[model samples]
Target: MSYTYDYPRPAVSADVVVFDSSTDSILLIQRKKDPFAGSWALPGGFMEMDEAADATAIRELKEETGLVVAQVEQIGAYSAVDRDPRGRVVTVAFMAEASTSESIAAADDAADAKWFPVDDLPELAFDHSQIISDCFSKSDKG
Candidate 1:
């Protein structure tokens, strides 16, 4: 069953911030596609029709970085009108912890995946820089 509407709707996506507490670093993936190709960004993608935001985050993480996370805490939702270049995309961001001992290999839409110190990260794609900053701010308070 399908329905069509005259009004437009924003696309939804999910992003994950995988922090390695032991090293004080976070996981980043080099995008393999345009709109930010070669730039570092969080592991994420558009949500599927059958899955929830959190599930999308976990799936994208595993597909792009080869790291599976069982649990994640919701950071928040980003709905800035100009957030995504492709269109009006609202992203739900999640945070998770992974052990440095776990190995990650770039796959799917990611050209490369690696860890970077939270304070010394490279220029990130989209609104990721802000998202990461927000995550840290929230964590610092708790």
Candidate 2:
């Protein structure tokens, strides 16, 4: 018998869940770019060549949210049909626990950024809501 592995080629991206302990809010941004314009989403972007996934996530958090990650860990991977508006995309979600959430803002492709309470979240673009759900579920496990 011959064995083969169909290599999966999906665009890799990272999502940063910046949490604000002061207000108990999570960071979200209004995407200025396509795939989901004028909609709320976590601070994230695609990975560059030779970039590590966790590093990319942190980098994205800094680039998009002006917030440095004090601690970060891999949450999970999300890949589903039509997950992205552009094309098939696979995202490696990473949750960042920042020491201080204050003084954080948005830039780059984010039109506007702000923090919202977890209980009062806005309609999110893509399957980010599900990703957040998964993150909380994982947290509940431990």
Backbone collision count in every prediction?
0, 0
11, model 1: CA deviation in Å? Answer: 0.7
* TM-scores of all predicted structures: 0.95, 0.87
Model 1, position 18: C-alpha lDDT score: 94
Q: Candidate 2 lDDT (Cα, whole model)?
A: 0.81
Question: How displaced is residue 118 in candidate 2, in Å?
Answer: 0.3
Query: Deviation in angstroms for 89 in model 1?
Result: 0.3
Residues 1-142 of candidate 1: C-alpha lDDT, one tens digit per residue: 9999999999999999999888899999999999999999999999999999999999999999999999999999999999989999999999999987899999999999999988799999999998999999899522
Q: Write down the TM-score for model 1.
A: 0.95
Prediction 1 global C-alpha lDDT: 0.95
Specify the poorest-scoring 10-residue window by lDDT in model 2: 96-105
